[model samples]
Target: MKVSRLVALLIRRSPFRAMMLAALIAVCSVVFSLVSELSRVSTEGLDAAIFQDNGYLGTYSVSLAGVPLTIEDQFDVVDRAAESLDMSVWRYSEVLPEVESECPPFDQVGRRSLQVMWERPGVPAELDFGHIEGVNAEWCIDGQSIPKDALFAPSSDEEAIYGAQLYIDPAYANLVALSTTDPITYGFYVVSGREDDQVDALRFAVLDEVASLAEASGYAPSVVIGRVDSAEVNVRDAADGIALVYDLIRWGVLLLAGLALMTVQMLSARQRGWFQGLLIALGAGRARVVALVALDTAIVAVAGLVLAVITLGALSDPVASFAEQSLQVQARSLSATSLVPLGFGIASVAAIAAVGPALMVVRRDPLAVLEAPRD
Candidate 1:
């Protein structure tokens, strides 16, 4: 018989069995796909947050003595060293103390720390303050035209910005009484003790778009440099932990589903023993019988896969939300990239479950099968 006709006959004779097989496959596929997607989302979210907050995936700290390096000298050293390194330079800065006078009173400063952040002309506004401790400022690209109310100098001081985290010693925390809402400012004092001579302390900002020339310049000891790069290794490492748990759960579900599919296929094959025997009497080859059985399995598996894709798409939002809440990270959306494993999982389950019944019927003598009573 033609493949289409054979499939139709099988469906007509065992619609419920086919449905059960399909349901099993669909459930397994959905579970695996959801787990994979959730892992991707959680890992990516963590990676992004970490990179954004720190400006670099890795941090290099340099201890400064009481005499701080001049911001110009530090930048020159960093810029030169970054030029020769293999890594991408995103942002670089020196964490420095701001004069108490340049900032607001300790009580009003709240929990916010006052450290200068270096700014660039075309950096994204959202990323301009990507969770480094600081209040939002009306940023100006033109250094020369800063508003009078702006605490930062407009021209050569363009790179200066404040941090949100007010780093205070535990003993001084009560003195500052820094609440989350406090407005904080950081100022610098001039060597001559003239307030007007005060220059904003230098904090550095480097973009990943730049090459690491400074690191190669041999001035590594003069400053602390932080580097952020698009590294998926950390995210993948995080996902591996989650993936292990999901894999175990998926295997258990697959085992149960496989058993159900196997039982149904075997029973159906047994019940149609006479049919099998007659087919053997008709000179149907073993290969033909095997093909027929395999076809049936494929049909069920494909049905399940289709149903799963539909179900997952429909439930993506809820699945994403659950994953985000459980993982405590942003959830990722379903995409074509996640479908490959889903398809493989469903196919594997269907193929494995079909083997026992297919082999049993295929190997049986046609006359014996025909003589056997239907189950």
Candidate 2:
């Protein structure tokens, strides 16, 4: 059949009907697209919430030879572990041997007393710790636990002993000059920011690396990895529940949108029963008629998809703004990968919906179709 003839038939069938189908497709397409994007955003939000509410997940304590690993040692171990895992590892260490009385509380020194226990000595200068929060710092280890931005700056001449608190803590001035020639680091926590799916694998991998390091250092069976407490489990469960809700919503919306689109296409084809019969009676082959019906549906489907793409492009900024303000997640921009699902979904529904209508038109004899009531 010629393209011109197919178009004429479409025009005769009422452009409004085609327009309506296209509009439905466009709307459904956009709905699913937004749902997909929102799924990703909601996931990100959930991850953020989990990290905030479940601090235990990100922080792990380590002990070597029955002794709490020092921040200096922790850095070496974590650096090696990070290289092995090809991921980042954070340090949040507590200053060794809390001395509240001998050291005279940080407040007496006229400095803001941070209750930070972990002292990350010799942390990489280039490493950014901006994502971490709620690191409590103490007078003895004021600038170690906080993010890199508030990190203590030591002069080039003192860089060799910078991690030793040789200059930062006046209280530790004597310790640096006397019994402790090296930097003092006590108990610390190791943190890793990984996706939910990778948590278990990464945890085991880190433990393995820690164990390997322990064995090499002759501290075998003496290194202990921290376990998540009941409170941490509860928080993790809540975060998981939020993720489950998002999954249900995303799939539910897609399912409904698909059903609506299929129904519309079926009804549209069934409504054109008279026109189909007329074409057949006028000597149009059943194959030609079926092809035309399929082509018609395809045209509408394609138009709707294009319209949806245009509409989504125009609304991207507004949607992103709303997502940021209401959802508190950085909205991901649309990409070709993201559009793939939408395309496949629309195409699948259109093909399936067209099947029923095409079968109905093909099975009936032209004479019977013409004689039968329009209803």
In order, the Cα lDDT scores of the candidates are 0.51, 0.57
Using lDDT as the measure, which candidate wins? 2
Model 2, 123-241: lDDT tens digits are 32332222113333333333222223433433333322222231122233333223333434333345544323334544466566567556666664444455321135665677678
Displacement of residue 65 (Cα, Å) in model 2 is 3.9
**How many backbone clashes can be found in candidate 2?**
7
Model 2 RMSD to the real structure? 8.7
- TM-scores of the candidates are 0.54, 0.58
For model 1, residues 1-375, the per-residue Cα lDDT tens digits are 775687689789878878877887888777777667655665566545544443234333322222234545444443543343422223333333232322323324433233333332223122222222244332221122212233322221121222333222222222333323343321221111111211112123222212244345433322222221223455545646776776777666766777778778787777766776677688877777767777887788889888988888888788668766887765544568777766666667777778888888767888766666655
Q: Which candidate achieves the best TM-score against the true structure?
A: 2
Clashes of each: 41, 7
